[model samples]
Target: MPGAVEESNRRLLRARDAMDRRFAEPLDVPTLARIAHVSEAHFIRTFRAAFGETPHRYLQRRRVERAMFLLRCTERSVTEICMDVGFSSLGTFSRVFRDVVGEPPSAHRRRGPLPPVPTCFAMAWARPATDRAVPEKRPERLRP
Candidate 1:
């Protein structure tokens, strides 16, 4: 039974790796499930069990992570950064970024990049808490 559980976790990791590698692509439960060789329902359940967050949330978090880097390091517009990070709509991107990071993209960008440090340390420090509730929608300010 432990071995079976380990195998299930491995499969889930494979699917999650695909998400990490292709975070900008359109990904869905069905596709991820097939990658894990499990049913959609089972994939969702097992993925949550293994990873502590749903696949969609995981992907969104990944996208936001990338966007955070881009926002802090580049002079790109918020819309460009949003689309670059795989969010199709500016409003949706702003909303999700707010939910995950506790502030809108513009605000985060204004704060500037994290101090020079090891990439691993920066990423770990910047990663959002997955269990935090998505905040209520607010009027997004897209200005730099």
Candidate 2:
């Protein structure tokens, strides 16, 4: 690969790493673009090309991944987990969780105990498989 392309990828990776570390924070395209030293539109396009997902979607996935760990390992309530994982609304969290994990958080939490293995291996094994289909739109019910 050319040096320019390689350097661009490195910059993208740095932004991605920031997203991974600060997934709980409100990370917008402009912030990420600044981190990558690119225009917002270019950052979105190049990030999608390099990562196979948009930066927003990538951040959502990271948040959901952390929520999965909290759901399985901690006795925290689902709403608490949702808020702790950076989702402001429980409805959105449940919807995104169901879309990404193929089940509601409660169902997922009850599925099984974590296997007796290394934490890294267990996390990898438990991470939700990505579904490329358009997430189904559902009516949101009010929650207290």
Candidate 3:
């Protein structure tokens, strides 16, 4: 049983590694499933089980992380960074960037370049907080 679990984890890691390498490319569940050698549904379920997020969300976070680094380190326009990070639309890029980083890309950029700290420390400090689940919006009650 432990061996089976390890094998499953290895497969998931392989798919996730592909995602990390090709984040700038248009990737989909079918391609990832093929990489994992699993059905699409099973891959999604097990990925979430292992990583605590869907593969799509994981990829979005990865792209946003790269965008964050670029925003801090380079003077490229937000739209350019958006396209470079594989987001096709500026609007979508802004929205997702905001969602992941808790600020718009321009605002994040205004913070200026990363401090002269170790790269690992800088990345650890700036990584988006994805473990906390976003709360669902509740309907407001009508007053009598």
Candidate 4:
């Protein structure tokens, strides 16, 4: 059972690595499923179970991460950055950017270039909050 689990994880990692490397490409579940050597439905289910997000959501987050970096580090126009990050429509790109980063691309870019920190540190610091688990909501106390 452990070995089977390991093998399944390995397959998922291969597909995820491909997504990480080719984030700007038009990736779909079929291609990712082929990479994982699983049926599309299984791939989607297992991917969500293993990674805590759907493959499409993962890909969108990856793209938005890259766009966040580009927005902070480059002077490229928002439209160019949007297209370069694999989004077909500027409106969609802006919407997703806002959803992921909590702000539009131009607004994020207005913060100016990243400080002169190590690339690894910069990336880690600039990473969006989507990867973290959301805290459970608590009920409010009654007021007097």
**Highest-scoring model, TM-score:** 3
Span of 10 residues, lowest total lDDT, candidate 3: 130-139
Estimate, for each residue in 23-118, the C-alpha lDDT of model 1 and write its tens digit: 999888899999999999899888878888888888999999999989988999999999998989999999999989999999999988777999
CA lDDT, every model vs. true structure: 0.89, 0.87, 0.91, 0.88
Enumerate residue pairs that collide in model 3.
none
Comparing 2 and 3 on TM-score, the stronger one: 3
After superposing candidate 2 on the true structure, give the runs of residues whose Cα lies further than 4 Å from its correct spot: 134-144
Candidate 4: 10-residue stretch with minimal lDDT: 130-139
Model 3 residue 113 distance off true place after TM-score fit, in angstroms: 0.5
1 against 4, candidate with superior lDDT: 1
For model 4, what is the error of residue 16's alpha carbon versus the real structure, in angstroms, after optimal superposition? 0.4
TM-score of each: 0.88, 0.88, 0.89, 0.88
Instruction: Write out the backbone clash pairs for model 2.
Output: none
Error of 3 at 108 (Å): 0.1
Report RMSD (Å) for each prediction in the order shown: 7.0, 5.5, 5.6, 8.1
Better by lDDT, candidate 2 or 1: 1
The predicted structure with the larger TM-score, 3 or 4, is 3
List pairs with backbone clashes in candidate 4.
none
Return model 3's CA RMSD, one decimal: 5.6
**Which 10 consecutive residues of model 1 have the lowest summed lDDT?**
130-139
Q: Give per-residue CA lDDT, model 3, range 9-113, as digits (tens).
A: 999999999999999999989999999999999999999999999898899899999999999999899989999999899988888888888999999999999
